[model samples]
Target: MSPVLTYVLLVIVMLIWGLNVVALKLLVEAFAPVTMQAVRIFVAGVSLFIVLYFLKDLRWLNKKEWGYTLLATVFGVVGHHSFLALGLAQTSASNAALILGMLPLTTSVLAMIFLHDRMTWLRLLGICCGFIGVAFVVLQNNGGLGTISTGDLFILLAMASQAFSFILIKKVTATLSAGEMTAVMLLAGSVMLFAFSLWVEPHGLDTFSQGSWWIWLVFFASAIIATALGHVLFNMGINKIGAGQAAVFNNLVPFFALVSAFLFLGEPLLLSQIFGFIFIATGVLLGTGYVDEKLKRANLMVHSQSKPPVSIHDQIEAQGQHKAKSDSV
Candidate 1:
């Protein structure tokens, strides 16, 4: 796909993910968090399987690929979804959105460590800004460091797990297609999540039948659109661009989620959240190298413009000088 189209698709994925946060919040409020996520992911996995099978793209993994896929599944699907659902159960979708916006910074840090990516001073500053932004949202209720909510902590963990998973996905994508890896990971992780939910919330399965038609609709939308298609497109973007570059698009999620939460869930838009988003957006732009790339381009333009254009006469004179020097030699 063209770069422009890839970027547009990435933006669309972010929008879906942002709205899905609100959808998840609604589902978790009506059902058990882990159980709902397990079922939702199972649906997504099955959908992907059918699509892949029809496309003749589904294939078995070797032992090495299985190892990487399983690890990626643990962090990306099970860990991320488990914590995200649990977090949204206690925290407002707005707060969770802002916290999750730190994904770009977190992914960059992981990439620097695992992939030996360079880290500049600007990126370090961006990381600080991201943390401060998250703090603003996470601590908005308590107004102090000591009283951070468990939900916010869970959200942070979810962000970290997802970021780390991107690094693993990057590694595994060398040997496996993003779609195949994502399908396997989702299916495998859903099983683990189902088991965990059964152990913790034995009656959780019963709540599924209690949801109304609209709730089930939201559940299916979140699964098929947000989880399955979203990840597939996102991983494709990651394959085209690097993980860190793809992650920078996550900055849009907080804005989309904040608006959706307010409009749909009746969550208030707090002043602190506005400020938090500003910081997070700035951080993502800087931390993920977007700003740096722009600045480099700007610098090149300035440097190119700084030099006076050589006249025709000057060019001829230069050529004459060069010829004279060659004759003298």
Candidate 2:
């Protein structure tokens, strides 16, 4: 696919995920967090499995592939969803949105450390901007530093887990297709979540039966569209572009989440959030090499324009004139 198309798809994925934050928050308020997430992920996993099976792409992973897939499942699916659900239960969706916006920086740093990707000064500046932006949003509600809520801490852990999983995903996708890996991870992760929920909240499953029709609708939409399809497209984007570049699109999630939360959950929009969005967007551009790529292209254009290419005839004529002048001298 064209780069533009891939980028558009990534943006759509971010929108879905942004709205999903509100969906999850609503669900958790109505049901147990881990229990809801387990069922949601299970639905997504089953959907993907059915699709893969129909396409004749389903197969067993080899031993090494299984190792990586299981590890990725633990971090990406179980850890991320578990913490995210718990965090949203206690925090506003807007707060969770801004905190999750840190993914690009975290993913880029991990990529640099684990994948040996080069770190440019521009990207470093971007990371700094991202931190400042998140600080603005995170500290806005509380008076200042050291007053962050437990919900925010859980969201941070969730972001960190997802970022680290992106690094592992890069490794796994070298040998397995993104869809296949996602399917296995989601299914395996859902099983872990179910077990955890069983231990902690034995009656959690009863909450599912108590939900209204709209709540069930939200659950299915979140599972199929946001979790299943969203990951498939996102992982495909990672496979096409590098992980860091693809992660920069995550900057859009906070903005989308902010809007969605305001509309759906009656959350108030804050001035600090607008400023935070700007900083985070700018940071993603710089931190993910988007601005750097543009600069490199601009430089190449300037150099080409300043020293235009010479034709073979022009070169020969210049050489001949030079030789005549030298002979005369």
Candidate 3:
């Protein structure tokens, strides 16, 4: 597919993910946070399972693959969403969105550390910008050097968990197709989340039964659109362009979330958040090598053309011919 089309799909995916934050906030008002996550995971996993089954895309995993998937389930599904659910319960969706905008930067750093991915100075600059941007939002909210809020901290933890999980995913996606890997991870995460919900929220499932039909609607949207479809597209995007370039798309999430929050939840977008978004987005753009890639390609072309074409075989033939001509002379 064209890069433009892929990007369009990415925008839709980010919008789904952004609105998902608002959906979570609303859902948790009537449902337990962990319970809501469990249901979302379950529904998303089951939905993927059905689709994979129909497409014959489901593959059996070996012990090693299962192990990696389990690890991913722990970090990506369990830890990431667990903190995110609790954090959203405490913080505003807009705050969470702005904080989460730093995901690409964190993920790039993790990739550099764990995956040994090369980092140019541009990427390094981007990483610094991202941290500064996030700090801007956090410090401003904390009243200039005051302690950060519990919810904000949790959101940061969620970002770290998900970022590290992406590093693990880089390794796993090497062997497993994105769809297969996502399905396995979601299944494991759903089971674990369900168990956690059972232990944490005694009346969790009962809340759903007591809630209105709109709750179910939101739940399904979160499950199918946000969790399942969103993840599928995310993995696909990663597979297409690579993790760094794909992460650049995350900068859109905060903007989308801000708008969604305003329209749906009546949340206000503050100046700090806007500034944070700009810094983080610019940082992510640099960190992802989006522009550097074009320059690199151009430089490669120039360097390749600058070298004279020479083949050892041709040289050898020329030498022989020259010797014969000299002997004739």
Candidate 4:
């Protein structure tokens, strides 16, 4: 595909992803927290499971991997979704997006602590810049000190859960296909959320509303579109464009989110947002090996349009090297 078209598709994916925030906030008005998550994840999980079953490649995980998978579901699905659902309910979606954007920094810190990942000076600098952006978000949301921060705190919890989950996922990704893992982990989250809602906060059981249709929109959009389709496309994009270009999409999420809020919710962001982007972009550049990879790719690309270069041997070697680099990191 042309560079223009690839970018266009990426932009569309980014927009759809940002809608997840606004959609959750809207659905929160109609459905109770646990109930909403139960339904959303269940639909998503079931849908993905069906697709995986048909594909014939989803594997039953090994015993040890299952343990990490369970932990991942606990944090990745259960804790992350619960905190985010409640957090979005109490706070504006704009705030949630800004806060959720801290995942990279959170994941980086967690990786260093738990996964023995190293942080180079450049990466640490990027992380510091990202934290400064997070500080702006916190200040904006809470209206400064001596104010309530339940919403901000909840988002932080979600970030922490995500950070924890990322480490667990790194451990498990070696053993499972992304689809197999997503199917199991999401179902686990749905089941737990189902039981929680069934017991404690089951108030909205028979709750039906005309506007609740948006909840399904959030479910399908999030589950099917964002989670399933988004991830599948991500894998495909990774193969086609290489991980570096695809990694760029991760940063697009926040930019699209802010723009969506500006258009839909009348959120007028301050100049501080530029700083946030700078931090996030730089952090992404440093953390994902993009900064270095770009220079490498540029040098390789300059080698030839005239020659039918880059045979299958070269491609395999490059991919193997990339995989080894990821494993070492």
Candidate 5:
């Protein structure tokens, strides 16, 4: 695909994701956080199970492979989603976007530390610069990662769980078909959450309603749109590009989110926001080796005035047929 098309796809992904953040923020008002998420994942898993049932070989998995479903559940559903729900209760939508924006950096670092990934020194420098830029965006008002309030820190940990899950999925890639792995993992996670909701919440299935539309809206959005369709689009995009490239494109999430927030919450758009875009775009480029450190500043200037510019890294990596790293992009 051409670079423009590739980026447009990224924008679409980010926009959907951005809207989700805003939607979820609206959701926590009514639902007991974990209770709401459990419903979402359960329904989402059911949806995928239905798809696979029609697709054939739905029950073809051997017992040994199905064992890994437990691990996928721990990280993907139980660990990640539960923490995110709790964290969302504490953090701001913009804070979530900015912190979650660091997924690429976190993934790269974790891969290097535990999964034996490598990068050139220039790329490393770029990563450092990218973090530095994030620091400016987040802490420009204060100093030293200062924007990371206690609630923000909780959400930050939730983001870290996602990165850790990525590496864990990489280790399990050999044992699972992308679809089977994802479906099984979601099943595991959803079941676990369902049980937890029963045990932890004061009222179980017999519990009274929380609020109007809030519970149902969060459930449908999280389960249907965010879990099922979002993953499908993300993994489909990952197949066209690569996981690393998808990670880079994910840096656009905050941009989408900022717009969503403006539309929904009437949040202010600051000049610092522009700088964050520059740094994130440059970091993605550096991560992919499409541009040098010196060139980032220039590209930043030009792209600021243009329509969303095509990231060359996107074009190069997205070229040719490739398998997706289908671990819930």
Candidate 6:
């Protein structure tokens, strides 16, 4: 696929994900948070399984791989979604989106610490700025740090949990395909959340009114569109243009979320949120190595002095000729 098409798909992925926050906001009004999350994960897992089954590409993970998969499921599915659902119940969807925008920054820091990924001074500054942005959004002109709501705190922790799970993801990549990994994690998460809902919010599933089909609509839509389909498009985009370029598109999530919230939910736009988003986006760009002026200049200089880009076909022919010459020797 062309880069243009890949990026367009990425934009669609962000749009679906942004709207997912709105769906969660609506769903949580009628369903208990844990119950809602459990249902969503169940639906997403089943949907992915069906897609992979028809493609004949699904692979069952072995016992050793399941061990790492279980750890990732705990962090990514259980911990992250638990905190996210709890946070959304207390915070506005718009606020949740803005706070969640710090995900890439959190992932960068965790990768640096755990994976020993290279980090420059610029990245350090970006990390600091990202935290400051989160503070600004959390505090929201309340004049002190005490104003940060419980919801915002939960969202922060949720981001951290997701980030930590990313660290584990690298370890499991060799053992599982992306689809297999996601399916397992979602299945595990669904089981865990379902059990939690039964234990803590037993009456939740019973409380759904007969006429509120809209709630189920939103729930299934989020599962199919945002979670399952979004992951497929995201992986395809990464394959087409590479992960680094694909990641840059993630900054659009909050922008789309803010727009959807304002238009659909009639949420107010706050000056602090705009400022916070700016800093957060800037921080992500720098922290993720997507926008470093020095690196760009260095790359430009190298490209300027290097040979022209080579096509795969041409490279293959050149390699064949070189092998032929070596055979004669």
Global lDDT of each model?
Answer: 0.89, 0.87, 0.84, 0.74, 0.69, 0.85
10 residues in a row with least lDDT, candidate 5: 320-329
Prediction 1 TM-score vs. true: 0.86
Residue-by-residue lDDT tens digits, candidate 1, 1-329 = 88899999999999999999999999999999999999999999998887778768788899989998999889999899999999999999999999988887888888889999888888888888888888788878744345679998999999999999989988987878888888998899999999989988899999988999999999999999998888778977987886657877888999999999999999999888899999989888878777777788899999999999999999999999999999999
Task: Compare the candidates by TM-score and give the number of the best one.
Answer: 6
Q: Mind giving the per-residue lDDT tens digits that candidate 5 earns over 1-329?
A: 76567667767877888888877776654577777777777788787777667666265666666665566568667877777777777765765676677777777778778877667776787687667656655564432345555656666677777778777777766666566667777877878887887777757444326456655666687677776767766766776776655666676778788788788868666666567666765665675444543476688877897767678887767652233544434
* Full candidate order by TM-score, most accurate first: 6, 3, 2, 1, 4, 5
Q: By the lDDT metric, which is better: model 1 or model 5?
A: 1
Best model number under lDDT: 1
Residue 8's lDDT in candidate 6: 85
Candidate order by lDDT, decreasing, is: 1, 2, 6, 3, 4, 5
Worst 10 residues of 1 by lDDT: 139-148
lDDT of 5: 0.69
Provide the lDDT at 232 for model 5. Answer: 64
TM-score for all models, in order of appearance: 0.86, 0.87, 0.88, 0.81, 0.75, 0.89
The model with the greater TM-score, 2 or 4, is 2
Q: Residue 44's C-alpha lDDT in candidate 3?
A: 93
Residue-level lDDT of model 2, residues 1-329, one tens digit each, is 88889999999999999999999999999999999999999999998888778767677788888988889888998899899989999888998998888887788788888999888999999988988888777777543455668888899899999899888887877788778888998899999989988987899999878899999999999999998878777977987886657867777899899999999999988887788888888887888777888898899999989996899999999999999999999
Model 3, 1-329: lDDT tens per residue?
Answer: 77787888888999999999889889878788888888788889988887778768777888888887889889989998889988888888988898888877788788788878788999888888888788777766533545678888989999899888878887877778878788888888989998988988888888877778888899899999898878778877876777657777787899999899999999877777778888888888887666678689899999999998999999999999999999999
Looking at model 5, the pairs that clash are none
Candidate 2 lDDT trough over 10 residues, lowest sum? 139-148
**Per-residue lDDT of model 6, residues 21-81, tens digit only:** 8888888777788888888898999898887788676877788888888998898998899
Angstrom error at residue 310, model 3: 10
Clash statistics: count for each candidate: 0, 0, 0, 0, 0, 0
